[model samples]
Target: MSDALAYDVFAKTCPSRGTLEHVTGRWGGLILGALHEGTFRFNELRRRVDGVSEKMLSQTLHALERDGLVHRDAQPTNPPRVDYRLTPLGHEVAGQLLGLIRLVEGRMDRVLAAREAYDAEHEPVTGRTA
Candidate 1:
């Protein structure tokens, strides 16, 4: 067997942790999910990912590209057009993320009910919970 050490996500200093954070950040997952459908231009991506500011989207794309999970293609046209798509690595990760998204969506009702129950049980005597 090879002596290569396997990556441990729980390790404090593991490089994968940073990558994990990048891939699963507020915008990263959405960006990857959108890209899974196919390539999209910058504006198209922004439109698809509602509520993401242009600055945040640009930053997220740059980070994903740096991590080799996204491919950005720039075309030299009258007006430069940049297209974004998922790399093979990104496709795999996005698939897993989609599964997670679906799971959370499917269970959101349960989560909401749990929250309501917890809030009701923990309601303050003053009726104003911090």
Candidate 2:
């Protein structure tokens, strides 16, 4: 919270590196993106994120929550309900990620072509079949 304290993500000991990893890692990004749509209970979020296992989802959510990007609400009911949503900071980060996702998706054809060309050129050396 100090303006004098600078964060260099590339630095080996930088705390920002951990936060960046939490925000951009596989499960983290998907969790944030899904939460960007709206608030969701744990199971709902799990379903929305598709392939995330319960443990991974729980861990990612905890990390994001600690980073102040995700908000977790626990309601006391006969069957307790917990909901997850993006904080203002989370929304900002998710918005940027969504743009990157859209760009990659839109350019998939070019990406696939490049991959094919690279694979074709290296297949023999790599001992990869097909």
Candidate 3:
């Protein structure tokens, strides 16, 4: 493999950009975090992840699976059972993502305060002339 291929994410034309996008998208983080706990059915995942549409969930799952981060198991049963879980690679990344989540949660107060200060300074004064 070429040196450029070693870190393809930096390449504009590399496919890793799509993979990175999939892994870091809004629904992707939540889905990975949910699966970190254990395997869950489609409905269960949908419930675990709030405000995710059925189509979005399916698309995210498919993306994750294609990237080899998620495992989909189809059981041979009466109604056919399907479960989704993280692969070893998924677990590793999930742990990192969870840590990031915790960091944001812990610092939310500071973040909010900063946002408030910024807005206070930036908001246009109704009585002031530009």
Give the candidate order by descending lDDT: 1, 3, 2
Candidate 3, 17-52: lDDT as tens digits: 998898889999999999999999999999999999
Worst 10 residues of 2 by lDDT: 1-10
lDDT of each: 0.95, 0.93, 0.95
Collision count for each candidate, in order? 0, 0, 0
Q: Tell me the spans in candidate 2 whose CA falls farther than 4 Å from its real position.
A: 125-130
Candidate 1 structure quality by residue, lDDT tens digits, 17-102: 88899889999999999999999999999999999999999999999999999999999997999999999999999999999999
Q: After superposition, how far is residue 112 of candidate 3 from its true place, in Å?
A: 0.5
Clashing pairs in 2: none
Q: Candidate 1 regions off by >4 Å?
A: 1-5, 127-130
